[model samples]
Target chain A: MRIAELSRRSATSIPSIKYYLREGLIPGGRTTGRNQADYDEAHVRRLRLIRALVDVGGLSIAAVRDVLAAVDNPDLPGHDLLGIAHHAVSPTPARRDPDDPRWQAAREEVVTLIGERGWLVSPCSPALDVAADAIAAMRALDQADLLSSLPTYVEAVERMAAWEVAAVLARGEPARMVEGLVTGTILGEILIGALRRLAQEAESARLQGLTAPE
Target chain B: MRIAELSRRSATSIPSIKYYLREGLIPGGRTTGRNQADYDEAHVRRLRLIRALVDVGGLSIAAVRDVLAAVDNPDLPGHDLLGIAHHAVSPTPARRDPDDPRWQAAREEVVTLIGERGWLVSPCSPALDVAADAIAAMRALDQADLLSSLPTYVEAVERMAAWEVAAVLARGEPARMVEGLVTGTILGEILIGALRRLAQEAESARLQGLTAPE
Candidate 1:
């Protein structure tokens, strides 16, 4: 296969495929002749993965690079590879002034939630910051009741996360496991986010009598 | 209170506040004199809401505007208000070629999931498109197991969405109810996403024996 076929099969534009190749997001194809190259199945798979990350998972180019690097390093432990991918896709922590009481309170609440749930996350985990940022925003907006339901959200997420980790580990291939974890983590968010909204519409319709209850 | 005071109280920079004002994201304060305006507590609150939506909720400026317009329309029913907010913040649907079999299959799967769940969403809901996009991406990346777990995710999200609708409606005041739903829907995503990542870390650690189980 050539670059044109790779682009067509991967559903990516030729220019975008060239860009990914130039940026080393995908390994270079074999040199077939002067100013010509031949791509293979590996290139097609990598291109699809890159598109999935950028288009569906909303990951930045740099984040995709980091995740791909982890994917390429089969010697890395599964857990470490997952950690690198998670860190790359995690939201940037919101800035908070030291004197901001709401942020301080929210940060403390995040720590408490982690402790109460017995989650074995590090104190410095970026997820903690992301959680606190959300809490602080809720408090600032006078919508703290949203946070009051944190336990329910945590219960659902914990169960799903556990299942996800087990599923990826069950693959038994280090490279494939890492790829599963990365795609599952990022694309999984999109899936859940969309499902939640659909559920909200259904629930709202039921409440409004727009649709009868099941 | 003046623009300076609004900026200080909202913890937003003067230029940013001015930008919001210019963008009409926030209503103008009363013009009290030449080149001077008197902002009140409402302005302060609105600024905070804008910041929460933009910074923590990761909503675009256009999304923030749509949500704010919904907030201002207290006459709108709670469900309708929520619908507007949800539509605004929903992820833009990924493009799919009409001839793509994977996408067509994913679309049918999404519809089936909704039907099995007995969800009352419309056929044209953008959430459906978002879900299908995720499924298609998962299939393209050869991580279809992620979509296989869609049932579990849908069950959890449905429960949470029901609780959220009830919580918001219990607020009594239409304005407050709408505000609660908007904040909960948007900020709740951030909170859940962060919690999910934290839970994943914990699960990963336990699997790797990095932390002792309780």
Candidate 2:
């Protein structure tokens, strides 16, 4: 196969594939002539992954590069691969106001929730900061009563994570497992957020006696 | 209360409060003596909501204004309010290539899922497009097998939205109910995303026999 075939197969543009090769986002094809290089199935696969991260996951090229590096790391344990991929795709946490009483209260709430659930989250996990920041913001806005549903939320996501991990693990091969984990984690968040919005709309309509969509 | 009191009560700075007033994100206070005006608890409340949307929800000032409009629409039924607020805060949907067969397949899958679940989602809901786009992206990346878990994901979010709607409705007042919906919808998405990340990490570590954090 050639770059053109790879492009057609991956649904990526040829110039974009060239740019990825120049940027080391994907390995170069084997040289066959002065002006031609022969690509293979691996090139096609890598191009697709890069496109997915950029177009769907909205990751920057550098972040996609980093995610690819993690994906290619043969020695990286499966457990740690998720953390790296998550950090690559997750939003940068907002600047923290450590002295804000509301922030302190929110952090305490998150720590307490994790403890009660007996989950094995690292004390310094960035997700902890992300969760606490959202909590602190909610508290600042005087939405404390809404936080009462924290237990319900926890239970829901717990079930979701279980199913997600089990599904990914079912892929068997270590390479597929890691790819599944990254794709599942990033794309899965978008899927869940979108689905939740639809469900909320339906639930609101049901409670308000609105007619279903035709 | 005056501007300074509004600042202190809402945890927003005086300049920010002035900016909000200038932007009409909040209503003007009653004018008093030269360079003086009287603010009140409503001012404080609006300021907090503005900050939450801007800071935590990552909404632009214009989006925040639109959300505020939906929030203040007394005649708008609660069912319609969710749609407006969701559209206001959601990411602009990408340009669609209607002829793309993969996208068409993904859209059909979504419509079928909605019908099977008997969810009253509007056919024109932006969320339907969002869900379909995500699914199409997954398919393009050769991760279609992951779609098998869609039922589990849908079920989990159904439970979450049910609890969330019930919690918001319990607030009683129409104003409070609308406020709860907006806050819950925006901030709740953040909370759920963060919690899901944390849960994935915990699940990954548990399955790998990794030790819990002290």
lDDT string, candidate 1, B75-121, tens digits:
88777777776776666654766478887788889888888888888
The chain B TM-scores of all candidates, as shown, are: 0.78, 0.86
Q: List the residue pairs that clash in candidate 2.
A: none
lDDT of 2: 0.80
lDDT of 1: 0.80
Candidate 1: segments with Cα more than 4 A from true spot: A1-69, A91-95, A98-101, A212-214, B1-76, B91-101, B212-214
- Let me know the DockQ for model 1: 0.61
TM score of chain A per candidate:
0.82, 0.88
Name the lDDT value of residue A32 in candidate 2. 98
Residue-wise C-alpha lDDT for candidate 2, range A79-188, written one tens digit per residue:
77777767766776558787888777888788899779978887767777778787876776778788877887898888888888878777765556656766777778
How would you encode candidate 1's per-residue C-alpha lDDT over A78-155 as one tens digit per residue?
888878777766667546564787777888888887889888887768888878888887887778776667888989
